[model samples]
Target: MKTLLLLEWMKVRKYKTFWAFIILFAISLAGINYFIHNVQIQTKSLTHGMADIQIFSFPQIWSTTAWAGGFSVLLLGILIITLVTNEYSFKTHRQQIIDGISRKQFISGKWLTIIVFIIFAWISYFILTLIVGNHTENISVFSGFDYAGYFLVKMAVSLSVAFMFALLFRRSGLAIALYLVYVFILEGIVKHFLDKIAGGLGMFLPLSAGGYLVSNPMRQAIPGIETIHIQPVWILLTCLGYLILFVYLSYRYINHADL
Candidate 1:
């Protein structure tokens, strides 16, 4: 595993695009959370306490940051796609195999890279949550911190989905384009129709299952609407199922497909 990770690190260390994407993702996460924090403050002042929503406060901070982190994960997904597809574009995957590494090692290296990215993202969110939540009134630091775990699962599910696309397509352009379209348009449309036909079953979709883990905390502030709460365990299980499926499919492709 260390050899695999070190191999991935050697590749990533010199990759300018990887660093660019990492920087962009960090900025996006911080910038979006900062903007929302200001909005929450301004809303409180403008409404004169009539509509005070504590998004940055203790428990809510975890969910708020995790939810906000979702948007930034898109950039990471693109980065994953680029990294995987680059291996094909440059024929490095074949070179690695020719150099005595088995197909399993190559795919395992990719999976390790994905895990590293997930850890980086999760750490970024954790630090940002602490920095932002410190200014807000809160009793406990760890309250509602389970959202951090949910964020990890979300990242895994999302990046694995991207990895699967890259393995399936082997072209960055097509993989990324289809990924964006599916995430933003196709899945929503499919989920919409599925929900209409099956009622709530749409939540089982790959992204939706992960998304249901950390719902929008701000929605609780809205009046006259009952929020439908699903069990976290169920959502977690669904996400795990999709995660395994995506990883398995990617592994199978790499194991059998001619490079």
Candidate 2:
């Protein structure tokens, strides 16, 4: 696994765009959280007892950061698509195999890179939560491990879908644009109409199931907010199911492609 990661790193080590993504993801992650925390502090102080809501207070803070952190996964998605599809675009994917790496190893190396993204994201969330929890409130670091766990799993699913899209499309720009369209516009539209005929069906969509994983507690407090409630277990199962399908199909696609 380490060797696979090394190989993948060699490919992107000098890639300026890759570095730009790292910087962007990091800055955006921290910046957005800092912005939201400030907003929460300002507005909550005006409301009686809202200050004690624990939005950024330790245990609950873990979940809050997780929910916010999910937004940046879109960046990672674009990153993976650009990186993987670039291999095909530049014809280096074939060269890697010509240089003695099997096709399976080639795919594995890319997968390893995605796994690193998942781990890096998890660690970022853990560290940010740790720092904020310590300064904001006295709380157990491990109190909401379950939420953290779901965060990691949902991220894995998100990355897998991105990776699969990269493999299928092999055109970075198209893949990234299509991914955004499907997730932000296409899926939402499909879900909106689907919900009218069959309640709770939208929650089963790939992105929707992932959203069900890390919930925003603030949404629950809002009156007249209509949202479907599904069991976390079911949502998780749905996510895992999609993860498996995506990986299998992506693997099969690349394994047999003419690249």
Candidate 3:
């Protein structure tokens, strides 16, 4: 596994695009959370404490940061897609196979790369939560930390979805275009109609299920706001199911398809 990951690292070590996306993802995560923190402070000052919600305080910070961090996860998804499609574009995947690595190892190496990206994201979120929370309020560091776990699962499902799309299309442009459309447009549209047809079943969609794990932290601050109530266990299971399915499909495709 270390060998496989090292090989994957060598491919992207000097790739400017990879670093660009990584930096972008990091900036987006920090920037968005900073913006929200400022907004929360401004609201407190304007409302004179009536509307002040302690979103940045301990437990809430975990969910708030996780929810806000979801937007940045899209950039990581793009990174994964680009990395996988680059393998096809440069014919490096075939080269690795010719070098006597089995198909499973190639795919395993890619999955390992995805795992690394996911860990990076998780650690980033954890550090951001601690910094933001401590600056806002000193509370139990581990309180509501399970949201960090949910964020990790969300990253796994999202990046795996990107990986599957990249393997299926083998073209970065098309895969990324379709990925954006699905995440930003199609899923919401389909989920809306599905909800209209059958209440909350729309959350079962792969990305939707992942998203269901975390919700808007400010939902409680608004008066008379209604939010869907789904058990966390179901959502977690749904995300894990999709994660497994996506990995299986990607492996199957690359295992049998022509390079």
- How do all models score by TM-score? 0.95, 0.92, 0.94
Alpha-carbon RMSD to native, per candidate: 1.6, 2.0, 1.7
lDDT by residue (135-220, candidate 2, tens digit) is 43455578877999999888988888888878878999899999998878998999988888898798898887887888775675
Rank candidates, lDDT, best first: 1, 3, 2
What is each predicted model's overall lDDT from 0 to 1?
0.89, 0.83, 0.88
Worst 10 residues of 1 by lDDT: 132-141
Name model 1 segments beyond 4 Å from true.
45-48, 135-138
Error of 2 at 236 (Å): 1.3
For model 3, residues 231-258, the per-residue Cα lDDT tens digits are 9999999998888788788778877888
Query: Quick one: ranking by TM-score, best first?
Result: 1, 3, 2
Distance from true location, Cα of 4 in model 1, Å: 0.9
lDDT of 1 at 224: 80
Compare the candidates by lDDT and give the number of the best one: 1
TM-score of 3: 0.94
